[model samples]
Target: MEMLYAKWLFNGKEILKGLGCVSHNNMVVDLLPIKLAKKTYPEAVVKDYGEGVLFSGFVNAHTHLDLSNVSIEPYLGFVKWLKTMIETKVQANETQTDEAIKKALDSLIKSGVCAVADISNTLKSCNYLKKIPKAIVFFENYSLRKKQAQEKIAYIENNIENIRQTYKMKIDVTAHSVYSTHRDLLGYTMLKNNPKFGSDLFSFHFLESEFENPFVNSRGDLFEMLQEKGLIDNQLHFSSAIEYIKSLGDIKKGLFVHCVHIKPDEIEYLKSIDASIVIAPRSNYYISKSLPNLELLKNSGINVAIGTDSLASNWDLNIINELKFLYKHYSHIDPAYFFGIATTGGYTALNLHIGFKKGFYAYPFFMETTTNNALEEILQ
Candidate 1:
């Protein structure tokens, strides 16, 4: 047994002073005061991390680890970046891809991310995501034709059980987005959601740009771009991404990434479904030159989580960097609250099992403080 005490502790809900956590073999058993921790676990070794904060590590609610191998410098042009990203993914060799995955995960882990809800296109990162304490790899399926979609479904139907058993990991099939995936594909994959992992625990890249909604609604620059590339036809259209998702099936109950163009009612709809929004503010600014209405998201009382997105758009996969960005952007809000988004808010958003049984925050860390607020100071 080991005892870890710091100036402050985050117990998956709120930060409190004068507390410590006791654990055995990497699993947290109890969170108590220093005296009680010593009394309860008399045989344990105590590590006094003085004048610092100790809590379970950050939970990255959304990221694309597969994109670790790809870095399309942001704001050159969203379309050009998109094309370059696709082209790079296609051209990269297997060894380089694997190495990049390892490098990216090492950086994330070093930066204190214990859990991740990752969006995967190739599912290459799934093999390595298990390295983290908690990982949910959402394998994105995209197909316009029902036949093609069925084939992908059949592949998962046949292999998912073994994959789960072999990998000892949680993975679910998800639609890429309203614009990229067919309704049949979306409906089919969504219906196959894992109830064990929360039936609505899916992530979609929704309304990250101004062009997204207009294209989903059938008239925009993106629509024109897809048309020019012969990628989409006049098959389906909806008033909004939310409507399009509703048209396909029931409202999902997990993190929705981006949401730069989300509306007031749409935010309420997310609340109605008990969903969380995973904001990658840095990545959003890169693609759309605007951040999500953080003021509105905060006041809306929705569970807001944080992510760095993939390195393809953002600079790093570090969750701390994400917190710092949010802090700088919304200095009005308490920085400690942003701290919760990276930790408690993220774990709750993903519906991760907490406490001794399983959870990432169950594994805590100690970071020496340098400012008034140890929590915010750790980020600095």
Candidate 2:
């Protein structure tokens, strides 16, 4: 047993404990209003470093660990960056894949991130996450080709099962996005969602850009871009992107990424379904130069979470950076309440079994503070 003292400890529900002791499996076993536990082995113990805030390690709800090679690319317009992303990948090379992943992981840990919802495009980063303390992998699937959607879904299903069998790690499917995924692929993937894989969480790229709005709703600019880039063939028809996703069967409990361009009706529809939204503010600003309507989201009572996205688009991968940015942009939203979105809201969105379980699960970390305000003390 080991005992440590922090100014504050954050339990699952934002409960602050002045001092706490964390046991093996990296869970907070005991916490107190005022340093309550007695040390059994004083001589063998390490010194208590005093006067610092400790909260449950931060949780980054969305990130692309594989895209760690990202540097400054063109910001503002969607098509410019999308074109660059397509053309630049072959040149970036894979030697830095490990280094970038390592750097991002290290940065997450240093920032007190205990868990992450990392979206994986391939198995390259899976090995790195295998050794991390806590991580949930989101295997990304994309199939815009009509003839290839079925095959793509089949591939994703098999790959997910393979990953589960190999690492015994928690894995979930994230249909790449409304614009990149075909209707059939989305439907098939949702229909194949099984409890056997220990993955019930669903995530998908939503409206991050105004370009995607008309394109997904009526297959407008997206279709033209696809044809121009040789990425699409037929003229697809859909009433709305949200409607297309809903048609993919019931995904009432999934995570919807980047609702910046989400229409009011779509937001209402999503709320009616009990779905949560993961806002990638930095990435949103990087791509679209605008922030989502936080006031509307708040008033709608929709659960909103935070994500740093990948370094390719954002300056950093730290969730704290995300929080600080949010503080700057959406001044109306409470920092303390938003912190929960980064931690508990994100964790729950991925269906992670959080908190303390005697034999099953372990609480990762806690926020400790002399004051009752968890966010104020930690930020200070």
Candidate 3:
């Protein structure tokens, strides 16, 4: 029995002026003109959010909630950051990781994130995501050795369902990247999970660094570390990450994360597969001193979403702060475009319904502004 009117309302798409959102029993009922809404709900209590835009909160398409407690600083290059993060993981106790997961979820909630696509190694964050309306916990397959990959595969085959039931979380196994996961593990997990769930768009950390190109082809530092006693030189090597992955099978609609170094032909391939990508701009700048081509991605037909990565790689897990960063630095792109990816594109990527739909839950948030450039004002 509430009627909330705003100067502008965003429905995960276009912004409409002078609309009222009607909700009852804590669920959104309809959106209509203020006058029409009045006629529809004659006895409802009303509140006008004057000089502002009211929107359903954002969907964070990709993040590592488990690393929320890991401290990060700028200018720590990718390799060093990875080493530091590994050291911290080795040292951090179970309680510490649990606390970090709780804090990360709380931060995302307070920052107005409606849903999340969280990358987890242990599915520990799954325990704390009760408050989020939609959540996808991607358990990473990051074994560099065949033995480790075999052990993990055995565990997944025997205990994945039991673990999911125990956690009460939708945990799906997926590859970490070209350098970390073995080719066998990648194909097995992806082929195993990609068709079971209707929206089985398992995410991959693809091409976040320029070094990955050489690493995948067995010519980089990462490749040297990946060498094991029984592993053949070309057992895991490929012409490109995309080619190796495509060799696995035709997994249409895969989610590619941090595509900072995605090439032109690769972009065309992504479009052809109807793929989605999540961009972590701040994390890229912090680790590699480069941001993805936001202008180009904005024009690309592939579904695009945004992420904050983790505190281990970036400052924080606030999608708003991330959007603001993109708005300020990547000024060539329109602010609304950033906003769109943060909302609709992210939901699309995660296979969740767009917010503000009737008969659905909408965690509404707002930006107070009188300017016609409300999106720009809020973002800047």
- Weakest 10 consecutive residues of candidate 1 by summed lDDT: 352-361
TM-scores, all candidates, are 0.92, 0.86, 0.92
Colliding residue pairs in candidate 1: none
Q: In candidate 1, what are the lDDT values of residues 210-290, reduced to their tens digit?
A: 777677677877677676767674456677777777765565576788888788899998898788888899898776567
Which candidate do you rate higher for TM-score, 2 or 3?
3
Error of 3 at 284 (Å): 0.5
Model 3 misplaced stretches (Cα beyond 4 Å)? 25-27, 192-199, 225-235
All models: lDDT? 0.76, 0.69, 0.79
Determine which window of 10 residues in candidate 3 has minimal summed lDDT: 225-234
* Candidate ranking (lDDT, best to worst): 3, 1, 2
Q: Point out where model 1 deviates above 4 Å.
A: 145-147, 191-200, 355-361
Candidate numbers sorted by TM-score from highest down: 3, 1, 2
Candidate number with the higher lDDT (2 or 3): 3
Q: What does each candidate score in C-alpha RMSD?
A: 2.5, 3.5, 2.4
